[model samples]
Target: MTRCRLCGSAALVSVVDLGATPPCESFLAADQLDEPEPAYPLHLRVCTDCWLAQIPPLITPEETFTQYAYFSSYSTSWVEHARTFVADAVQRVGLGPDAFVVEVASNDGYLLKHVVDRGIRCLGIEPSVNVGAAARDAGVPTLTAFLDPATGSDVRAEHGPADLVVANNVYAHIPDVVGFTRGLRALVADDGWVSIEVQHLLTLIEENQYDTIYHEHFQYYTVASATRALAAGGLALVDVELLPTHGGSIRLWARPAEAAGEPSRGVADVLAREKAAGLQELSGYTEFSARVAKVRRDLLRFLIEVAERGETVVGYGAPGKGNTLLNHCGIRPDLLPYTVDRNPYKHGRFTPGTRIPILPPEQIAADRPDYVLVLPWNLRAELVEQLSFVHDWGGRLVFPIPELSIVEVAS
Candidate 1:
């Protein structure tokens, strides 16, 4: 039985089955043309007792994240996002020259750069060689290893406990939930705080975001389930804040068990909402698998109908979520001629499993396809604005999941 990673509950039900898929980030090199790619079961389940949503176990972190190709500095919006986060966190946490801040999975020191400018000491724990080297180049002291208990102890022994630990969008990627949280407890100072951002499960279900499933992301977290996992590792949830980044996410502020403070109203409000919505009930999960199946049918029907009409359809954003959606819906190059990506690294490559070609955004303007499928629907507003020139050709943008709709751009 595939039990819950945190609570080990056997009362688990399959929520969404995305079929077999390779790790979304594992883009192939041109030279290795004949190299076989391995695909694993992309099935998701929800634990009734803990309400933790997770995928079936397959690959380990060491196999997935080492020498990673992604760099946080690639996105202009993301860089600005990091800058704002650093400024707000430094002020809100009251961090200064004497205080130390530690960031886990701190890819390329995206957030630490602003902290360093303020003359505050900051340490980054990054597993990817390319990203770690970038951080080091930026003069940010970074340890090139996964944040586990032993590494946490080593960091504390050398630099002492940190005043603030920032773990942005990493809580969902960890397979060893217990060990990772315990490491946080080991590294945080008595009065220090740990701020973590995770994509909320409630938003995922409500918005029909089944595309977020992939091997690299092991778990989908709700605030209630996260609290259970963290408290199990001797941490207390002090506050929660909703953010518009990454579709929809919840930023949680927690401290070691000894720190006493009134819990934020957002925390209790979300917890009660989840319970009232039947997140704690098994039937809530059992019904979700059916919804996922409907999404697959609807998307495939829409794509095939568009293709049959002899209308050209191309995809936008070669994101990880897009990979899952494309592969699961059995969409091949025959349906989506090619996809566009802002990341230079992915532009020339093909998406994993689906093998759909990726091109630059300029290709979209050049081709002027009849319909442009916005795969990363979360960023539709931003993307539509950037690609507004499609209006000149009378091209309409199509969003598949949550619902299939076309929005005509103003000419």
Candidate 2:
């Protein structure tokens, strides 16, 4: 058995094996579709010691993130999520024009643009060349480097200690998660806080969001696991908030251990809740694989039945999780003819393994397919509102995860 990335223990328990899939964000061009594509194993294991669910890093961050097709600004809902956070963080930290804000993995300046608008100094560390260029164009000072201990030290020296460090949805992307957290501690001022947002492991299991598993996301965190990682870096979690974004996520506020005061009651409440759910033990991780298998079976059966009836199907949103679900289920253009994404970078390309043609959102109105499978179920509400016109043509919406079902559009 492979050792746990967090605690380095040999007791990594099986959670689920999604088989092999191409890098979830590696969308392909038409010319490249016929060529051989590499697929890596999508197996998940939970560390019995730390209770952190994780997958082996089959691919490096350079291979997975540097040339990503995803642009956060494309998702209006996600950008709004960033805006709300920036507003709250500014107030909570009492940030002003003189204060500096640094965001690790700040994609396309989607969040930092707001910080700059308020005249606050901000720096973004983005590894992706294309997305970083876009962020620079948007007037957010961006550095094109992955943030590890050394790079974090350099950034801290160059930009000064940050009053607020934002690592939204990025904690899972690092294989050296401890080093990444160390970087956060190294960069933030002694009394400053770091905000980390990650998809909650409890929601992943209970909601059957198995699609969130891929090579890019090396580790999944429970509150306990996250606390351990932060504590190892001499950071203390001061507060926690459950967010509706990313299926269900936890936004943890942490401070340097030396300066951290008594943590809010929310911390103890969340930890106790996780313990009640058995996350502190191995038994909670068991039976997840069986539940995942059932989802795969039920989904395949639904798609097969629909295809047999000659019903037309197309997909909405080409998020990374969509690629994982599509590749794992072995669904191709035959099952899903084409998928539409608002992000232009993905348009005119094909999904990595499944090779479903990616189109513009207007394709939905032009084709008016019988069913529009909403692949990114986490943003179901936003997608439903955006694609309301589907109801005009008697088209229905399908959400594949947590259970595949047709969404009943409001009249």
- Identify the candidate with maximal TM-score: 2
Per-residue lDDT of model 2, residues 263-302, tens digit only? 9999999899889888888777788888888877887888
Clashes of 2: 0
- Candidate 1 — what's its lDDT? 0.85
RMSD in Å for all candidates: 1.8, 1.1
Q: For each candidate, what TM-score against the reference?
A: 0.95, 0.98
Task: Give lDDT per model, in order.
Answer: 0.85, 0.90
Instruction: Mark the regions of model 1 whose C-alpha exceeds 4 Å error after superposition.
Output: none
* Sliding window of 10 residues with minimal summed lDDT for model 2: 402-411
lDDT of 1 by residue, 1-411 (tens): 368888988988878777799898877666554789899998888887888889876988888789776787866667787889888888888987899999999999988988898999989999998889999999988999998888888999999999999999788888999899999888899899999998888878777788887888999988889998889878899999887777788899999988937888889998887777777786556566777778788878988898899889898888888898888889999999899888787877888888888899899888989999998787776777877889999999988767678889875
Q: For model 2, what is the alpha-carbon lDDT of residue 100?
A: 98
Clash numbers, per candidate: 0, 0
Q: Which ten residues in a row have the lowest lDDT in candidate 1?
A: 282-291
